[model samples]
Target: MKPEIAVLDIQGQYRIHTEFYRSDTPQNTIILVNGSMSTTASFAQTVKNLHPHLNVVLYDQPYAGQSKPHNRHQTPLTQELEADVLLELIEHFDVQYVLSFSWGGTAALTALASSPRRIEKAVISSFSPLINVPMRNYLERGRRCLADCNRTQVGNLVNDTLGKHLPSLFKRFNYRHVSTLAEHEYAQMHFHINQVLSGDPQCYLKATQRIEIPVLFINGEWDEYTAANDARQFAYAIRDSQFVSVENTGHFLDMEHKQASHISKIALLDFLKPPAPVITRPAQRLSVAL
Candidate 1:
C-alpha cells in the first residue's frame, strides 16, 4: 500500500516529514525512528516486514532526509530535541510501539525514559546507549573529518573503521551514500557526532534502568560501532528485555548482502507480531424443541 504523507509541526522547533503505512487489518501502531546518517528511506526493508502486521509511521528528523531546519541559523540539535520530537509524534499518531535503529535508538530510549504518555513495547537494533573509549575515538575521527569539510574522508573513515566489517555490497553502498551527502547534511552530521561525543554513560544507564516496557535489543555479532557487549549490558538493565546477537553480521545487519539480513528481518517480524487470539471451543448442548 502507498503510504500517506504528513508533516508534523513540533511547535517552533522544526517540522518533520512523515509517511504512514496503514495496515489493512491494523491491530496497533509502530514508529520507525532513523539513525544519525539514516533517513526514512533506510527503513524500506523494515517497513515491508511490518506493514502487514501493524500500522507503520516513518519520519525524518530535522536537517535529515526530507525534514528541513526551522531557520537559516544553524542550531545544534540534541538527543533531547530528538526525543521530544518522538514524544510529539507518538501523541500525534497514537503510536504504541517503537522500532529504532542506530542513534535513533538513543532518542527513542530518551523519550521512554522521560515517561512517555503511552508505549507498550520497543525494539532497537545496532544501537548502544553508552559510548565507550574505542567507540568515542572512532566517532572523534569522523568528527574531525566533518570539521575539515571533507565529506569524502568522512565516508572513508566509516568504511575504514566500522564498515570494514560489513558486507562488501553494503560497504560500497554506504560510501557512495555518505560521500554524496548534501552540504546541509554535513551540518546535521556534526550535530549527531557531537551528541555522541557528549553523551554521558551514567545518564544512559539511568535511562535504561527506568524504561518500564518490554524491549528487544538486537546487535550484530561483529558490530564494532555499537558493540554487542554494550547492547547486552544496557538490555540487562531493563526489567523486561531480551538481547539477540546476530552472528557473522556487522553494524548494518538488515542491509547485508547475505542471509544475515533475512535472519534479522525474520527476528524483527516475529517480535513485532501481535499476540494470536485464543480460540476456545464452546460447549455443545442438546435442543429441547422437537
Candidate 2:
C-alpha cells in the first residue's frame, strides 16, 4: 500500500509536507531528506525498499516541493531553521535514524549535533562539507542564468555541470526535471544555492565533530559536485563515522546505478541494526544477611 501524505504545522510558522510509510513490524524510524531541488517523490523507490524493515518519513523543505512557496526574499534559509523543522518532525514521529541527500545533509548534521540524544544513526549521501571551486563556479553560473530567466542558458549550464557526468538514460531524466521547474521553484532552488555558497563550511564540520552516534557518509565515486576526498574529510571530522564510495556512481547514486543503490541499502541496514538489549539481573534479597 502507498504511504499517506500529511502536513505538519511546525510551531505555527512553517507547514511541512510529509509522507509516512508505516511498517507492520517496525524496527526503527527513518527520516529521509531530499536534495535542494528534489522533492520527496525522488525517494519513492528508496522508501519502498526500506518500508518492510522501517517506518519511513519523507518530507520537502519549506520552499521546495509541496511545502509553502518561497522566493528570493527568503533567500538564505539558515541551516538552523532547516534543523528546527526536521527536529519537529523527528519528535512527532519518534524518528531514530536520519538519511539525507546532497544539500539536505547540512540540516541533518545540524540537528544530530544539536540534539545528540534524539537520533541513533545518520546516513549522508552525495554531500560535501566544503564547496569546491568547480562546484562554486557551476552554482554561480546557474544562478546567473536563473536570474536572467534564460531557459536556454540554464539548460546549457545544467548539461555542462551535471549531464556530462551522468549516463545517457539518466541524463535525459535529469534534463526533463530541470527544464520543467516552475519559476517559483527555480527561485527557491536558487535561494538554497546561494545559502549554501554563503554558508560557513566550518560550522558543518564542527557539527560532525559533535555527533556521537554512528554516521555513514556515502558518496558517488565520480560525483563532480562532491568529490570523494570531501566525503572522506567529512567522515574524518566525525569521531567514528564510516565512509563508502559507490563504484561507478555519480551524483544520483540511488537513482542512476542499481549496484550503487544496492550497496547503499546494505550499508544503511548494517549501520541501522538495533543494538542488542542489555539484560539486567534482579537484585538478590537480603536473606543472605539474615
Candidate 3:
C-alpha cells in the first residue's frame, strides 16, 4: 500500500492526525503511537522500511502534537482516555498489532490490561514501568528545561545523550521544538510533561501490571530516555515476552539503523512469525466503552 495522511474523528474532534502507510504484502497492521510532546513524525521513516511487511500507522497522542489540546475546563487524557484513543485508531485502521514509544508504551500496556482480548500483539520501546524506575532525574531535568524556557539545553540534552559527543545532531532530534514549535508551543509541551510526571510510578504501576498480551520490549544500548534495565524489567512483567538491546544504537534506533539490516529486525521478524492470540475488546478512554 502507498503512504497517505488521514485523520480519524474521535469524540467529535478530528484534531489528532494519523499518517497511514500500507504494506504491499499486508503482513500485519501496526498502530504506532508517539511519546510525550512528540508527533507522528517520530515514526515516519520506520513506516517506509516496514512497508514491505506492515501497514504501519503513526498518530499524535492527544494534547501533545497537532492533536487535541487538554482544556483546563475539561478532563485531561488519562490512561483510560488515551487507551480509548488507541481503540478508536485500531477500529478505524483495522489494526491487530501495536507499536509504541516511550510514554506511549505505558498507555499501550494499560489498554492491553484493561481489554485483554483486543490486543493481539504489541512492541513497546524506551518505555517501562515508570513507577519502578526512578523518574525523579528525568522529571527534574525536564521540569527545569521547561521552567527556564531553555529549548537549547532541552535540545542539547537529547542529542548529547543519543549522539554522545556529537554536537551537530542535537538540533535534528529537537525537530518538534527547534523547527515545528513556537514559544507558546514549548510551554504547552512542558505542561504536558508535568502532567505525565506528576503521577509518576504510583500512577503507572497499576497500568503496567494490567498488561496481558504478547509484548516485545526493545531498547537502544545507549537509550538514555528508557534505560536497558528499565526495558528488561518491563519485559519481565509480561509473560512470554522478549527484550532486545540494539548494539551501537542510541535512543533513535529506527532512524540511526533504518538502512542497516540490524539485529533488531531479527527480533521483530521472529516475533511476527508466531500467530497472535484472538482479542475480544479494548481499554478505551470511555472505560465502560469496551
Candidate 4:
C-alpha cells in the first residue's frame, strides 16, 4: 500500500509533515527520523525493507521537507523542543521503536532521555553522541559555504562530507537530493549543527546513563563524520546498548552499496524484534495451616 501523508500540529506552534505505512499484523512500529538536509525520501529503501513486518512512520523536522520553512532570525532551535516534537509522534502512534540517522540521532537521544520509558528500543546509525573535531570542522566549513550562498562550495562540502561514503551507483542519487535542498533547509541544517555543538557536550552521554531501553549504534567502518571509535564510546556509555560497524562502508549505510544496505537491514530487523515475555512460576497454594 502507498504511504499516506498527514500533518501533525505540535503544541499549535508547528506542523510536521508525516508519512505512515501501516501493516495488518505489525510486530511493532518503527519511526524513522531523517538526517540534516534530508527528507523522508532518505528512508525509501529502509521502509521497503521493513514495511511488511513493521509499521513505519517518517516525518520532516521543522523547516525540513514538507514542514514549515524556518526563519533565519528566529531563536536558535533546541534539542529539547525537537525531542518534544518527536515524543508527540511516538505518543500519537504508540510507537515502541525509533530509528534515527545522523543528525536526527541527537533528537532521538534527547527524546529518550525526556521520556525514558516511551521507547522500547532504538537504532541510531551514522550518528555520534557529541560532535568530534572532524565533524566540527566539516560543519564549520558548511556554515561558511551556506553563509556565502556559495552553492558550488555547498555542493562540494556535501559530497566530501556525505556523498564520498556512498557507493558509485548511489553517489549520483545522493547528490541529486543534496542539490535540490532549499536555502531554508540549508539554514535549518546549519542551525541544528550549531545547537548540538553549543549545547551540553555530554548531553547524550548523560542521557545514556538514564535510558533504560536497549539502543543499537550502527556506524560505517569508514564513516568520516562519526568515527568507529566514537560510535563505540557512545554505545559503551549506554547501559544496554550495542555497537555494530558495517565493514567497508561509510556514513550513509542505509543507501550504501547493496551488500552494506542488506547487512544494515538485517541488523535493524534483528534488533527491532520484541524481547520474549518474562514468565514466572505461578505462586504455590498456601499449605495447610500451616
What TM-scores do the predictions have?
A: 0.90, 0.86, 0.78, 0.88
Per-residue lDDT, model 3, residue 21, is 81
lDDT top scorer:
1
Quick one: how many clashes does candidate 4 have? Answer: 0
- Once superposed on the true structure, which residue ranges of model 3 sit more than 4 Å away at CA? 64-76, 130-135, 162-180, 183-188, 200-203, 257-261, 274-290
lDDT of 1 by residue, 18-111 (tens): 9999988998899999987778888887887787788999998887777855333377677888899999999999999999998788799889
| Clash-forming residue pairs, model 4 | none
For all candidates in order, the CA lDDT equals: 0.82, 0.79, 0.66, 0.81
Q: Rank the candidates by lDDT, best first.
A: 1, 4, 2, 3
Per-residue lDDT, model 4, residue 237, is 69
Tens-place lDDT per residue, model 3, 203-271, is 555556666667788877766666777767654456667788777676667666543225666666677
Instruction: Please report, as a residue range, the 10-residue window in candidate 4 with the lowest summed lDDT.
Output: 68-77
Error of 4 at 285 (Å): 24
Q: Considering summed lDDT, which 10 consecutive residues are worst modelled in model 3?
A: 67-76
How many backbone collisions does model 3 have? Answer: 7
Best model per TM-score: 1
Write one digit per residue (lDDT tens) for candidate 4, span 1-290: 79888888888777888999999988888899888778888898889878878999999887777775532225545667888889999999889999998888878888887654557899888988657788889988988776666767777787777678766666676667666777766776667767666788787788777777888999999887887678777655688888889998988886878888889988988888866789999988987763
Which pairs of residues have clashing backbones in candidate 2?
none
**Across residues 217-251, which tens digit of lDDT does each residue of candidate 2 receive?**
88888787887788888666788788888888877
Q: Better model by lDDT, 3 or 4?
A: 4
